[model samples]
Target: MQSDADGRLTPGGGTDALFWGSLFRDLDREGSFLQLQIRQIIVSAIENGRLPLGARMPSSRDLAAVLKVSRNTIVIAYEQLIDQNFLIARERTGYFVAGLPKHIGAAAREPGGATRDDGRWTSRFAHRPSTYRNIVKPLDWQAHPYPFIFGQFDPGLFPTNDWRESARAALSVPEINNWARDLIDGDDPALIEQLQLQVLPRRGIRARSDEIMITIGAQHALYLIAKLFITPTTRIGVEEPGYPDARNIFGLLTPNVVPLRVDSGGLVLGDEFENCSLVHVTASHQCPTAVVMPLARRHALLQAAQSHGIILIEDDYDGELMPEEGELPPLMSLDRGSSVLYVGSLSKALAPGLRLGYVVAPAPVIRELRALRRLMLRHPPLNNQRVAALFIGLGHYRSHLARVGSVLLERARILDRLLPQHLPHCTWSRGAGSTHYWVSCRPGTDTVKLAELARAQGVVIEPGDVFSIDEGSARHCFRLGFSSIRTERIEAGVERLGKVITQTG
Candidate 1:
């Protein structure tokens, strides 16, 4: 069966019934009635080589007409295939068959009318060791509006000329030849000194050159810390609705990942830490919720860590991106007990592509982390670190930050105004000082559906589910990032997203 010029399926060639009827039989075995039928047909076609790998499928409307079904059915079928990895959809070019399955062909068919469970039998990943990939799906950013994509800087506003100059200068350095073998646990002393002088003071963190270790980025830093501190059964307290990457890292290293609740002030520390040996916190600006840990709570956290002999991994990932309010003291600044391990990154302030971050810990822990880092990637690339240090030491870094900060403030203002107009039912909370806003929608609203609708309108928003520890309460909130896109885009994006919510309601 093929589609005619008018976009209707015509049963033309011989064996048309055999081709079409086989699809129907397969659909009968599939549970879902409407879309599943279309999906089954597509899957069978791909499996049988009728639609080869990378072959474009008919448009949804044309296929719907051919199959005597509604366009909605075809759309849902296509969406299912896209979700299940059975097909790949190009934005405007329709769907194409994905790579061929390893099984489910003539080889799996029994001549005596017996059928084998080809999918189950031929799976190569069945016994693979458990890893983070199984728990986390690559976030689909295209499906929401104002998605607070973590760790992305405002690319349009970045100081490209300044960066180019610094990079070129660094490449031209006579000592650059040593960079090939300089990939090790410690970074350049000049870079470490620059971090100690330029970055730590703003957050009230005091560290010497010997205490800081450079890593690829905050994620890499967190991974190395987890490897060093977390044992298989160690109970690590993580903030509920926290950074997923942090939680995922700790989860992979240790089975006992404790979820600590948070409120307006910050982490609600109770007796949960009695048995917990380690804690990971985004103290500067809490991820997703964007709450800055209050000074009292910071002290309480520090006291708890000291009293319990626990380690505190303070991830100041986006500290510098915090809007200009009086500087909020980092945990390390107030940490008199030498228990806080402070990790900061330039990824958010500069650009994530740089992949440069540093961790300041006690001399002992720093030594252990360095050993672990050697086991991991040996060290981060030295050239970026040297150039970044040069940029900061020469004052170019601060200038770039000032420019980006101004743009972020303007964008944040635009978002604050536009959000209320577009989403009247939602309320926005400003953090102590951060790049994004935490938006709480009206109770009983489905943020997942809201995300879907926004996605349909070309706005990528981050749903609250990724941040929630209990998953059940994540549907009423979402995060909006104002630092990455242009200020003008914020208004239009919010307006378009608002239309989705209004129409859905």
Candidate 2:
């Protein structure tokens, strides 16, 4: 037995003594939780044969020292791996890889790698997906000094102690008995109770447990809604400059993705939506633009939907983040005809790695979706659902929400002060509360090029081209998210952005 150091293994533990820590050395862990990153790395190694079958892995202590994470973090990752069957443990010996694929071809290379055989994937498609033109921000964005990327969770805002406590509570014998089982085609009833009472009521949207279903995240929720309502013959209405991912999802199922115009008041309610079978909207804080759709407009949009027999899927993503006084109630709250289906997520307001979201619709719609969900994922993780229930049950969710709103509001104020002082030439739309700013450059400026070049300077910005259904006409717009950047970095990042804007012009 080589039991001298932390890396030592028991005699005859396994075949190879592999220390594959360098494989994750250059990986990015920004905006994501540590355990997830480590889990993903180990899974990738197993699939790629870098960690072959029966190969002994480095001890948890040694790997923790190498990765600069806590030994407990490595242990947690290992436990999850063991749970998922990617690794196995001896009674006292260190862990070893459990599974190895029969073959690892060039096709099985790292994610997004383009091998020679990759181009033929288009042949199997019924309709090709839309060509997304936006820059995919790197995952380890925290490693960068300036991150203006949208949709990232601020690590500083995570309620670690509360979440850990919630996890501990969920793992208790009684609670474990409740959440550890398959829950086949069922959700954590406690989490639904929390959502109905604590979460939805504030937004003025109320629902029964039968009317809601948990999803992998808001993205999965949106995808399911699109599958339910959209088809090749159906006309779907989307905002001109809306959430790109939503647009792409709808486009995949329908040939008609109608791009309606978005102004200061949000998506224009007009004849565009009249003929649409379904419409996707971000009414609270419009994606990309950060504009709140007015209350009057909300009523009018509902009226229009009723007249046209349209189903409106309201993505109430940022409603919880707004200041309570002036915020408009969600359209779902205002719907008397049961025409509005609401989408809400813990991922955006809490943590993306949790991949937890929910949909509120008619009970019939929920029943159908639950059947479909059973065919897809069965249900979102029982543990995540239960822990989330406790987090809300203990009031940590509301407290965390208030703290995040305060910090984002502070960041918004700082961004407002800095943007004018540094980049006076550009115009922007700032909402009462939202994570991002929609920036419109000078008449002839190419924001796409500016964004591409700014990355080289360590300032990552999201170009606006992808937000629009029509990318050709959206070259001068871009977005800056303040959620991830420190208040002190706002000025310099915008100053550097200003210089790049000037350089591009």
Candidate 3:
């Protein structure tokens, strides 16, 4: 059959007859309308590679005109194709054929029509959904009101210009040897110097360059630690009402996870230490609660770890953002026995996009971590690390941090003042030095439902249940992130969130 310029066969050709026959067959078999038939046609075309990758499909109007069907039917057909991954739509451009899935062997399909030979021999991950988790919903800073996003750093305060200049300088360097290979152990001299001379002393941890190993970020660092320390039956202790991602990671790695209660003083360690070998805690500022670990408890934790020969993984995730005056000493610094493996990151201090973090471990542990780092992705991007080191070495990092601290401190104060006006029944505690505020809701409030209502109104807030290890407590509490949004939006976001709480209650 001779095809026209638009790839459609002429009326005299067999194309029209074939199309009509296929449509009739599909309609007779499924009793579906024209839209469903069109959908099946497009799907079959994609599957058979007749509509190749990146090839633009006919527009709804054009397809409807050609097929003598309603435009709405074509639109619905296109929508189904987009949803099924048979087609992709660019923002302004029209829809195009999406990439095809990999082909499997015939053995994968059984005579009974099952993908596997036997249902009893199914893959462990067969039942899991193949959809990506949406991290954040679309947020309207002004209209929707209450915003409680976690790990949000104030963008207005970051030294964007200085960082750009630093990055440019690092890129402009004539010699770029490290870029070719991964510095798994992160042996960049400048970065090591900054860690030893600048960061460690500031945090009261005394560590040499040989003890530090850089990773992609704190998440990666935590993952490597889990791989090294945890096994299926290994007992691990994590702080109660702690970072959810950390809990999830540990849970996936090991079966025996002990939930240590966290109070105003930080991790409440009792006789549980006898059964646990590895403990994870945010000593600088406990997440969700924002409580600083007191000196007595810090010493007690170090002592417990030392006496039991346990390894304490100190996650100082947001330690650098603490205010100058009242910041407590890191647990690693308090460890005179060298039992703590300190993990620090620049995600909150600088930006999460940076993906820069360092682990200060003992000499032996550093060797094992380096091997694992090599096995993972080799190392983090060398140029990025080099620039980060340069930024830190040139005093720009400290200046930027000072700027961030001042801005977030001011924002925190604003949140404290405005939250009461909108949410009078809700009570907020003063944070030691961080971007978030942990608020206690009214006696009978449901934080999850409140979060849902806030999302419906176009604001994204994290419910307290994700952080709490104990049940029933999260219903009355939720965390508010004040770092990312503008100062003007803070009051309004809180106001909207307050309305959701009031209505839900």
The C-alpha lDDT values of all candidates are 0.75, 0.82, 0.75
Best by TM-score: 2
C-alpha lDDT (0 to 100) for residue 42 of candidate 2 = 82
Can you give the lDDT of residue 154 in candidate 1?
57
Model 2 residue runs over 4 Å out of place are: 1-121, 130-135
Candidate 1 displacement at residue 56 in angstroms = 32
Query: Cα deviation of 470 in candidate 1 (Å)?
Result: 2.1
Tens digit of lDDT per residue, candidate 2, span 82-128?
99888899888778878755555344655655456756877776765
lDDT of 3 by residue, 307-388 (tens): 9988999999878674746778888877889889999987667877788888999988988988888887777777887788
The alpha-carbon deviation from the true structure for residue 323 of candidate 1, after best TM-score superposition, in angstroms, is: 3.7
Please give the lDDT score at residue 345 for candidate 3: 87
Instruction: Estimate, for each residue in 308-355, the C-alpha lDDT of model 1 and write its tens digit.
Output: 998888888778765577547888888889888888888778887888
Off by over 4 Å in 1: 1-150
TM-score of candidate 1 against the unseen true structure: 0.72
